[model samples]
Target: MMKALLATVLAVTPVATVTRLSLPPPTGPAKVGVVTAHLVDRSRPDPWVATERFRELMVSVWYPARSVRGHQRADWVTPGVAARINTPDSGFTLPVTHGHLNAPAAAGKHPVILWSPGFGMERTSGTALAEDLASHGYVVVTVDHTHDAQFVEFPDGRIATNAIPPVATPAEEEQLIGKALDVRVTDTRFVLDRLRTMPLARHMDLSRVGMFGHSMGGAAAAGTMLADRRIRAGLNLDGSFAGPVLEAGLDRPFLLLGSESHDGEQDETWTRMWDNLRGKRYRMELDGSAHLSFSDFQVLLPQLGLPPDQVEPAVGTIDGPRSVAIQRAYVRAFFDRHLRHRDGRLLDRPSPRYPEIRFP
Candidate 1:
């Protein structure tokens, strides 16, 4: 929902003078390696457009690499996705990722985690978190829901842009978002199915699978977990809930993370979601964060050097590096506790190490 909403809004803002942007380094010991695959779901026809007969998706699979000494650094995003994210005229270059391209996977099978980005945002939106997790020995897969994302680039050099249109009313918007969740849920399931049999299947322990997402993608995480038992855990970052998950809460582990302004008090959806949880559930908030702080946008937008007033509307007042650090730490901790059976004690309460994280 944001490429048109935020990207269009961003177009009107004063362009930044900053020429280049770089992501922060990964915090774990293992080297990160990533591979992108173009997937075609012939069983399902394109829902947003009538001309297309099947659904096509672009997916990035990140893993713990044994060695990246000779492999090349991966682009944070494909050139096409980069253009749709930042207007070409802005003259700001996108960041490069720590992921090495097609590097060899580490020896032991690792826990698998799937990532879904915010509405209208590409999979690259969660690059910082994915890389950090992979560096910690998790198999992190990021999915870009075709036609729903701002742009998706495939291996054949073809690009697919968003096909969904704006809605005119709140009722219509709600229905459209539900439909996006429908697509996202199905996309996630299909990706999980493919991953179980892919070449990297040897590197993944499918039984230890988890999912997380930001914004609409966050809702999809809950939605997908509800629809599939294969996913052992789920997390939602500052996203509201809609559809069946609201009524049929999950029995598995789940965590709801929110920014300062997004809470059960403000969003009734969060309250309903909290009430229906039947299993282990935890909720937390980031004190100085905003909706976008849960994403890579937290790291990139600040470099724009927008007026202080303008900053709050986008990524919030929190410093860029601090936001990334908090997210990488907490998100990693949740998965480590639930998926790896490694409780790092960071999630038990607010840690002095990350003062911005609150148990609200």
Candidate 2:
């Protein structure tokens, strides 16, 4: 029943990437928790324009907390967005919050999920999905890929503006893809390792883990599954396949949830990845959905007074309620099935209840 209450109001896009200024106020008996760490891309160099000290990131881990009532919730973003409009290279500062006010803190080990946002998108782009997962008792670790994301905010007043990587040229796209695979997989693997040692995160259930992403983030999800055997399964939300993932020929349980543009015969990457799945594999397409459909922006656009055409027409096909509900159901089902080893009809087959979801 817990969902992103203010999801409709949080808008993030290619044009305007303002971040959360404060954590969502708590609610219910369930509490919330969050932590962030900087990750070096290793593959890219900071552009000349980037501040030398602002090259690193701060990635947050959100979960249901136990006793967040007394603790102060972090801001959703830094306070400078309004005043720093002239700073073209600034990042969004986010607050680390416990669950809604009066919400109960989660106890014991729960499932764990590693999250990746789309290309050129910060980890917060998938906040709606991430927060919902956290509310459902998953330790959601959202990775902030340095030099790739716009910016990542830290607990302190400091912010890390995205260090521009080597300019991505047409000729370098393939190399960038390869580098992305390395960056995503290594960063996730390190976090999993570090989580075991984190004094604060000692309660996590490391064995129960899954990976997911949107757009290029989706591709990174598949890449993580291939690179790490510790991951039980993976899910991709409308990301194309390339890089070493296809070359390796994936052999684990994976899901490809795509948009309308990516479901056709011309988009062979989706089909090729589908063909290469050696374990359980499923594909679903949302009618009229676009590349950005998987992100929360779909719901935030109308609330921001944006025109209908501002979002891809295909993305508009997915109404907010149905879209968010479907995302919650399927994502929870995927992680629930593999991480918890539970049986769920949501992942069993195409259902009449979710008429909007077309399984191919």
Which residue pairs in candidate 1 have backbone atoms (N, alpha carbon, C) closer than 3 angstroms, thus clashing? none
For each candidate, give its TM-score against the true structure: 0.96, 0.80
TM-score of 1: 0.96
Predicted structure 1: lDDT: 0.88
Compared with the true structure, model 2 gives a TM-score of 0.80
**Looking at model 1, which ten-residue stretch has the lowest summed lDDT?**
8-17
Give the alpha carbon lDDT tens digit for every residue of 1-360 in model 2: 001212222333323564434322322234566655655434434432444533344567778777665566544444543233323433343344343433344778877898888766677667677777787778888887755665555556555554435645877866766776676677777667767765446657888888899877888888887878888889999888877678676777798887766774857788778877889887888776776668766554444334566554525666765676787789888887788877866876788888878877
Per-candidate Cα lDDT values, in order, are: 0.88, 0.67
The residue ranges of model 1 lying beyond 4 angstroms of the native Cα positions read 8-18, 83-88
Instruction: In model 1, state the lDDT of residue 80.
Output: 68
Separate clash counts for every candidate: 0, 32
Candidate 1: C-alpha RMSD to true structure equals 1.7
